[model samples]
Target: MDPTDAFFTQTVVGAPFTVLLGRRRQPGGSQAEGLHINLATGESRLSQLWQEWALLSHATPPGTARTRPGRVRRLMERHALWVAVLGLLSLTGSAVSWGLLLWK
Candidate 1:
């Protein structure tokens, strides 16, 4: 088996991760498709949905998408702390809102 195919299949099949493939609109009125791999956890899916929307809205070239693993890792590392903080803040805000609503 090809190494690349083996890697993708292993990562996606029955693993704690998923590979999402879809098309996005390009700047010159064309469509660009890309692949995104994300964790299968609930919170990760929610975050990935938002990221997918943003990526689709401003589509990248096919080559860029295919070669984005390193870039994606770097970006996640850079924003990990801020992302965690925001996630905590959102959960706290939601819990507070729910408590207030139930109290009323």
Candidate 2:
């Protein structure tokens, strides 16, 4: 077997599935790579979902979706923080308004 095959195959003799996700070189440049939890079947549901999303997004108009996956992922990560901050500010403003009404 090829040397890289070892990297893709399992070393242990227990679990039926093994997953590996990382960056690797493609024909043009480096791209996301994954060895799914199931190697015998040779299919990753996660990868398929990602592929479908990529295709659907590219089919959309420019600026309608994230320009890049990494940026979009970052935005998603911070989305909750932004929402929480906004909610806190809104609540504070409402409380201040109520206090002004009480003073009047």
Choose the strongest candidate by lDDT. Answer: 1
Cα RMSD (angstroms) for every candidate in the order listed: 18.8, 15.2
Q: Per-residue alpha-carbon lDDT of model 2 for 28-53, expressed as tens digits? A: 53345433456897665556535555
What TM-scores do the predictions have?
A: 0.33, 0.27
| Candidate 1: residue pairs that collide | none
| lDDT, each prediction | 0.65, 0.61
The local distance difference test score of model 1 is: 0.65
Shift in Å, residue 64, candidate 1: 19
Model 1: per-residue Cα lDDT over 1-104, one tens digit each: 89898889888874443334443334564332333345575332334445677768666655664544698789888999998999999999999999999999
